[model samples]
Target chain A: MRAIVLASRPVGTPSRENFEMVEVDGEKEKLRAGQVRLRPRWFSVDPYMRGRMNDVPSYIPPFRVGEPITSEAIAEVIESTTEGLSTGDLVRAHLAWQEESVLDARFATKISSDPGMSPTYYLGAMGMPGLTAYVGLFTVGHLREGDVVFISGAAGAVGSIAGQIAKTQGNFVIGSAGSDTKIDELKQLGFDAVFNYKKSAPKDALRSLAPNGIDLYFDNVGGDHLEAAIGSLRNFGRVSLCGAISQYNSTGPTPGPRNFEGNVIRKRLEVRGFIVSDHQDERVAFERDMAGWISSGKVKVLETIYEGFSSLPDAFLGLFSGSNNGKMLVAL
Target chain B: MRAIVLASRPVGTPSRENFEMVEVDGEKEKLRAGQVRLRPRWFSVDPYMRGRMNDVPSYIPPFRVGEPITSEAIAEVIESTTEGLSTGDLVRAHLAWQEESVLDARFATKISSDPGMSPTYYLGAMGMPGLTAYVGLFTVGHLREGDVVFISGAAGAVGSIAGQIAKTQGNFVIGSAGSDTKIDELKQLGFDAVFNYKKSAPKDALRSLAPNGIDLYFDNVGGDHLEAAIGSLRNFGRVSLCGAISQYNSTGPTPGPRNFEGNVIRKRLEVRGFIVSDHQDERVAFERDMAGWISSGKVKVLETIYEGFSSLPDAFLGLFSGSNNGKMLVAL
Candidate 1:
C-alpha cells in the first residue's frame, strides 16, 4: 500500500518536497476481535491537514514526520471479522492519505450510500465540512431570517455550504472569495452579493455590499476580512469563527484584527471559536437538513476532484493557492 | 453652576488642557411639564468614558467640543415640577461632569439610599460598574463553582468587584494589577492571587500562578493581558470581554494578541464582548445579591475619591496613568 507521509515540516509554505509517498506493507499475520481490514476508495485532502504537519499543540495531535498522514476517507470493507460488518460495506474513518488501513471497527462509521449519488459526498458535503457549516450558521452564528451575513472564503468547503444554508433560510448573504471565478461561483451558490478580495480590499467591498451593516459574520479567513466585518457589524452582532486559512501556513505569528476588541466592546459582538468535532450533537439534524437541501436542489455541491492518488499533494497545496473552486478532494 | 466641557479632543492620552470649566445660569425661564432641576454630588470616572473623548462612532456618541461631557451621576433633585420627584430625592442620570442640569425628569433613575452605605455607592458599587462585574462573571463568563478565573485590570472598578465576586463564589481567582499597591489592595479584596503586570510579563505571571489552565477570563485590558488569557485558557474556555483600556486611547490601531485566533480555534475558546447597558434585566437581581454580599462582608467596595469639582479632569486622566486604584470618582 502507498501512503503519503510528511517528509519535513515546512517553514513558510509547503512544497512537494515536504510530502513523500512511500510503499507500506498492509498485510498482517493476525487480526484481533472487532478489527477490520479496509481498502480506501477516496482519499480526502483538507486544509486542516496542514496543521497536523507542524509539531504544535492543536485540537488534534501533530502528524509525526516520516509517518503516514491521515484524514477522513470512505473505504470499502475488503475483509471484516467485526459485528455488523460485511465484505462490501463502505465506511468512513480517519484513515485517508493511505491506500489501506487495518484498525478497530469502532472508530469507523458505515456510510449508507445515498441512492443515485456519489460516495465522495461522505468526504465533503455530507461529512465534516457540511456539519461544520450547519453548526457554525445555526449553533454558532445564530442564523436569523433577515440577518445580513458576510462569509469570508466563500468558495471553500465550509463557506460554500454556510452561505447556501444562510441564503435558503432567508438571510441576505454576502461573500468574499480569492478569485473572480470563485466570486461568480459564489453568486451562483445563492449569495446575494460576492466580492473578490484579491481584486479589491474586503473592507471596501463589505462597506458597499452590506450597506446596513452585517448582523452575523462567518469568519473563514480572519485577517482584514475580520477587520471589515468588525467595522461593518451592527449592535449585538455575532461572529462565528470557523478558520483563518490565510495564516495557517505562516512561518511566524500573524496579528489579529487591530480594531476587533474596540468594536467588540462598542457593538457587543459575540465572537466564538469552535471546532465541528466538539459539536457532534448536531450531526443528525445537519445531515437531515443538508440531505433535504441537496435533494430539493436548494443546496448544490461543487467539488474539485484530483483524478489520481499522485495528485493528493498538489490538491492539498492548492487550497492555500485558491486553485480549487469548492471542496478539494483526491480520487484514488 | 459650573460644568466641565470638552475644550478640544486629545491626540492620544487626555490632559487637563482638553477639559474646560464653564459657568452656567441655574435659573430656568419656566418649568415645563415634566422638567426637573438637579445638582449632581457624585459622578463616575470610568475607563469606558475614555472612548467618548474621541470623535468616533461607538456605543455612545463621542464628546463634542464645547459640549458638556457627561456620564452616570447621582444628583439631588433641586426643583421638580414633575410628579413623583421631590427636592430631596436622590437621582441617577446621564448627567455628570456638570454641577447642575435642567432636563426632562423621565431619563433619570431615582437612587434609593441604602440603610448604611453612602450615596456614592449608587455611583460605583451598586451602579454601572457593579452591574458590569456581575453580568460579566455569571451571565457572560458562565461562572462555575470550581472554575479557575483570571481577571485583567484587577485594581479598577469592574475588575476589583469581578475578582471578589468570583473568589466569594468559590472559584479560584487570579488577577493582574498595574501597581504593587493595587496588588496589595486586591489581596484585601479576597483575590486568591494577584500580580503586578508592570513588574513582569502577564503571560509569565499567569503561567506561574495558574498551573492549571484558566477556565474563565474576564478581560478588562486588551493587548498583552488578552494575549496572556488566550494562552492560558483551557479547552472550551470562556472570555467575558468587558474592556480593553490598554488600547482605548491609542491614536492609531494596535495589533491584537498575535496568536489569539489560533489559540481561540485550537482550544475552542468562546470570547464574548458585552456592554452592561444592554443588560438592564439583571439590575434588580444584581442589587439584591450585591447588597447581601456587602452586608456579609463577602464583597468589599473600594474607591479613590478626588475632592472638589476642579479635580474631575485630573481624576479622569489619572485612570489612564494607573495613578488611582479602585473606582475613581469625584465628590463635589
Candidate 2:
C-alpha cells in the first residue's frame, strides 16, 4: 500500500512537495465481524481540505504530520467480514487518499451505479457537494422564489451546483468566478448574471447586477467577497456562509469590513455560518431530490477530474488557487 | 413653542454647550382635517438619538443641524380635529426635544389610563425599549431557555430589560455596565452576573463570568464589547445587534475586529443586525406580553427621569456619557 503524508505545514499556499508519497506495508489485522477491506476507486480532493492541513483551531481539528489524509471516495470491497457487503461490491467510503484501506462496514454505504451514468457522479452531483449546495442554499440561505442570489466562487465545486440549484428554484441567480472563462461557464449554466471577480471588484459587479439588492448571498469564498455581499444586501437579507476559501491559505490577518456593524444594523441581516454536515438529517430527502434533478436533466454535474491518485496533492492545492472548475476529483 | 436643538455635533461626547434652547411663536395653520396638537409628557432620550444627531448614514437618517430632533415619546393629545382621538387623551407619538408640537393624528396611539401605570412606563418598559428588548432577544436571537446571555449596556433601557427577559425565560444572564452603581443595580435586578465595563476590560469580565461561552449576546455598546462577545461566543451562538452606543459619538474612525472572520467561521455563529422598527408587526404581541410582565411584576422597569422639557438636551446627551440608568426620560 502507498499513501501520501504531509511533509510540512506550508506558510501560505500549499504545494505538491508539501506532500510526500511513501510506500507502506498493507495490514489485514483481525477484522471485527462487521469490518471490510476497501480498494480505492475514485476519491475527492476539495477546497475544505486546506483547512484540515493548517494546525490552527477551526470547526474541525487539523491533520497531524505523518497521518493518512482522509477524504470521501467511491471504493470497491475486496474482502468483507460483513453480512451485506461482499467481494467486488461498490461502496462510498471516507477511506480515501490511498491505494487501498480497510474500513468498518458501518462507514461504507453500498451504492448502486446506473449504466448510463458514471459512479463518479455520486461523489459530486449526488454526493457531498450536491447536498452542500442543497442544504446551504435552501436550508441555511432560506431561499425564496424571485429572490436575487449572489453566489461566490460560482465556477467551482459547491458554488457551481449551488448556482444551478438556485436557478432551478426560480431565483434570480448572480455568480462571481475567478476568470472570464469560468464566468462564461456560469452564464451558460443559466446564471442570470456572472462576473470575473479577478477582473472586476465584487462590490461593483454586485451593485450593477443586483441594483435592488441581494436578498440571499451564498458565500463560498469569504473575506472581501463576504464584505462585498454584506454591502449589497437589502434589508432583512440572508447570508449563508458555506466556506472561506479566499482566506484559507493566508497566514496574515483576514481584513474585515469597514462598515461591518453598520451593514448588520442597516439591513437587519442574518449572517449564518454553516457546514453541509450539519444537515445530515436531511440527506434522505436531499439524495432523492438531487437524484431526480440529475436523472431528469434539470441539474448538470461538472467534474474537473485529475488523472491519477498520485496527483491528489496537486488537485487539492488547485482548489485554493482557483485552478479547477466544478468538482475537483482524483481518479485512482 | 420651545425646543432644544443641536447647535453643533460633538467631537467625542456631547455636552450641554452643543445644544441651545430656542423659542418660536405658535403660529401654525389650523388643522385642516386630520391633525392634532401633542403636549409631550414623557420623551425618550435614548443612545439611538445620538446616532441621529450626527451627520452620518445610518439605518435612520441623521438629524439636520438646525432642525428639531424627533424620536419616540409619549404625548398627551391636547387638541385634535381627528376622529378616534380626542382632546386630553394620552397617546404614544414621535415628538421629542420640544415642549409642544402639532403632528398628524395618525402618528399617535391613544393610551388608556385605566391600567393605572404611569405614562412614563409606556416610554420605557411598555414602549419602544421593551419592544426593542423583546423583538431583539426572542424574535431575532431566538433565545432558548438555559442559554447563557451576555448583555452590554446592561443598566440602560434595552439592555436592563433584555437581561431581565432572558432571566425570566430561564437563561443565565451576564451583564456589563459603565459604573459600580450600575453594576450594583444589575445585581439588584437579578442579573446572574454583572461587571463594570468602565473599570474592567469587557472581554476579561465576560470570560470570567461566562467561561464556557455565551449563547445569546444582546449588543448595545459595540466596539470592544462586540469584539469581546465574539471571543466569548460558543458554537452556534446568536448575536442580536440592538445598538452600538460606543461608536455613536466616536469622532475617530471606528476600529475593525482583527479576528472577526475567524470568529464567524470557528463558532458557526449567527450574527443578526437588528433595528426595532422592522419588527413593527410584533408590537401588538410585544405590548401585550410586556404589559403583562410589568403588571405581574415578572419584569422590572427602572427609569432615570430628568425633569422639565428644558433638560431634554442634557438628558439625551447623558445616554452616551453613561449618566443614565435604565430608561432615560424627560418630563415636561
Candidate 3:
C-alpha cells in the first residue's frame, strides 16, 4: 500500500520535500479482535493539518517525522473482526494518509448508504468541516436572527457553510475572499455583500458594506482581517475564532489586532476561540440540519477535488495559496 | 464657586497646563423643577476618565474642551426641589469637577447614612469600581470555585476588590503589580501569589507562580501583561477585559499581544470586554454581597486620598505613574 509520510518539518511555508510517499505492507499485519482493515476511498486536507506538522504541544499531537500523516478520511471495511463491522461496509474515522489502515472498529463510524449523497460528502460538507461551520455559527458565535455577520475566508469550506447557515436565520451575511471568482461564488451563496480581500482592505470594504457595523464576525483568516472585524463590529458583537490561516504559515508570532482592546471594551464585544472537535455534542443537530439544508437546496456543496493518491500533498499545500474553493479533497 | 475645566486636550499624556481653575456663578441660576443643588464632598479619579478626555467615540462621551470633567462622586444635596430628595441628604451621582453642581435629582442615588462606613466608600469599594469587579468576575468571567484567577494591576481599585472577592470564593488568586509595597499589600490581602511586574517580566513571573496556568484572567492592564496572561491560561480559560491602562496613554495604536492568535485558539480562551454600566442588573446582588463582605472585614477597603479640589488633576495623573496604592480619590 502507498502512504504519505512526514519527511521533515517545514520552517515556514510547507513544500513538497516536507512529505514523501512510501510503500507499506498493509496485509502483513494480523487482524486482532475488535479491529477492522480499511481501504481508504477519500481523504481530507485542511488548514489545521499545518499545525500538526510542527513539533509542538496542542489539543492534537503533532505529526511524527517518517510516519503517515493521519486525518479524517472515508474508508471501506475490507475485513473485520468486530461485531458491528462487515466486509464492504463504508466507515469514517481519523485514519492515516495511507491506502490501507488497520485500526480499532470503535474509532470508525459506520456510514449508512445514502443514494442522494455522495460518499465524498463525508470528507467535506457533510463531515467535520460542516460540523465546524454549524457549531461555530450557532453555538460559539451565538448567531441570532437579523444579525449582520461578516465571515473571513468566505470561499473556504467552513466559512461557506457558516455563511449559508447564518443566511437561513435571515442574517445579512458579508464575506471576504482572496479571488474574484470566490467573491462571485460567495454572492451566489446568498452573501449580501462580497469583497476580494486581496484587492480591497477589509476595513475600507466593511466601511462601505456595513456602515452600521457588523453584529458578529466569523473569523478564519486572522491578522488584519481580525483587526478590521474588531473595528467594524458594533456594541455587543461576537467573534467566533475558528482558524487563523493568514498567520498559520508565518515563521514568527503575528501581531494581533491593534484595535482589540479599545474596540472590545467600548463595544462590549465577545471573542471566543473554539475547535470543532471540542463540540461533538452538537453532531446530531449538525447532521440533521445540514442534511435538510442540503436536500432542500438551501445549502449548496462545493469542493476542489484532486484525483490519485500522489496529488494529496498538492491538495494540502493549495490551501495556503487559495488554490481551492470550498473543501479541498483527494480521491483515491 | 470654583471648577476645574479642560483648557485643551492632551496630545499623549495629560499635564496641569490642560486644566484651568475658573470661577463659576453657582447661585446665579435658579433651581428648576426636579433639580438638586449638590455640594460635592468626595470626587473620583478613575482610569476610565482618561478615555473621556480624548476626542473619540467611546462608551462614554468625550469631555468638552472647556467643560468640567464629570465622574462618579459623593455629594450632599444642600437644596432640592424634587420629591424624592431632601435637604442635607447624601447622594452619589456623576458630578462635575466643581465645588457646586446643579443637576437633575433623578441622576443621583440617595445614600443612607452609615456611621461605621465612610461616604467615600461609595466612590471606591461599594460603588462603580466595586460593582465593576463583581460584574467582571461572576457575570462576565463566569468564575467557578477553586478556579485559578490572575489579576493584572492587582493593587488598583478594581483589581484589589476583584482579588479579594475571588479569594472569598476559595480560589487561588495571583496578582501582578508595579511596586514591592503593592505586592506585599496583595500578599496581605490573601492573594496566593504576588509579583512586582516592574522588577520581573509577567511571563516569567506567571510561569513560576502558576505553573499549571490560570483559569480566569482579570485584565486591568493590557499589553505585555495581557500577552502573559493569554500564554499562561489553561484550556477553556476566560479573560474579563475591564481596562487597558497600560495602553491608555499610548499616543498611537499600541501593538497588541504577539502570541494572541495561537494561544487564544489553542486554549479555547474566552476574552470578553465589558463595562459595568451595562450590567446594572447585577447592582442589587453586588451591593448586598459587597456590604456584607466589607462589614465583616472580609474585604478591606483601601484608598489613596488627595486633600482639597486643587489636588484633583495631580491625583488623576498619579494613576499613570502607579502612585496610588488602591483607589485614587480627591476629597473636596
Model 1: how far residue B64 lies from native, Å: 3.1
Residues B108-174 of candidate 2: C-alpha lDDT, one tens digit per residue: 8887684647888888888888999999999999999889999999999999899988888988999
Clashes of each: 0, 0, 0
Candidate 1 at residue B114, lDDT? 73
lDDT by residue (tens digit), candidate 1, B1-332? 78889999998888999999998776755768898888888778888888888888677789899988888788889999999898999898888577778879898888877776778877777888999999999999899989999999988999888998898789999999998889999998889988999998988998999987899999999998888888899998999999998997888888878867778878888888999988999999999988888888888889899999889899999999997777888888
Pairs of colliding residues, candidate 1: none
Q: List the residue pairs that clash in candidate 2.
A: none
Residues A167-225 of candidate 2 have per-residue lDDT tens digits of 88888999999988888788788899998988889989988988888999898888778
Model 3 compared with the native: what TM-score? 0.98
List fnat per candidate, in order.
Answer: 0.77, 0.56, 0.81
- Cα displacement (angstroms), candidate 3, residue A161, comes to 0.9
Chain A in model 3: its TM-score? 0.98
Off by over 4 Å in 1: A26-30, B26-30, B33-35
What tens digits encode model 1's per-residue C-alpha lDDT throughout A108-160?
89988787457888777899999999999999888888999999998998899
Candidate 2, which CAPRI tier? medium
lDDT of each residue in A163-244, candidate 3, tens digit only: 9988888999999999999999998889999999989999999999999999999999999899999999999999999999
Query: Candidate 3, residues B233-285: lDDT per residue as tens digits?
Result: 99999999999998888898888888687788888999999999998988899
User: In TM-score terms, which candidate is top?
Assistant: 3
Candidate with better TM-score, 1 vs 3: 3
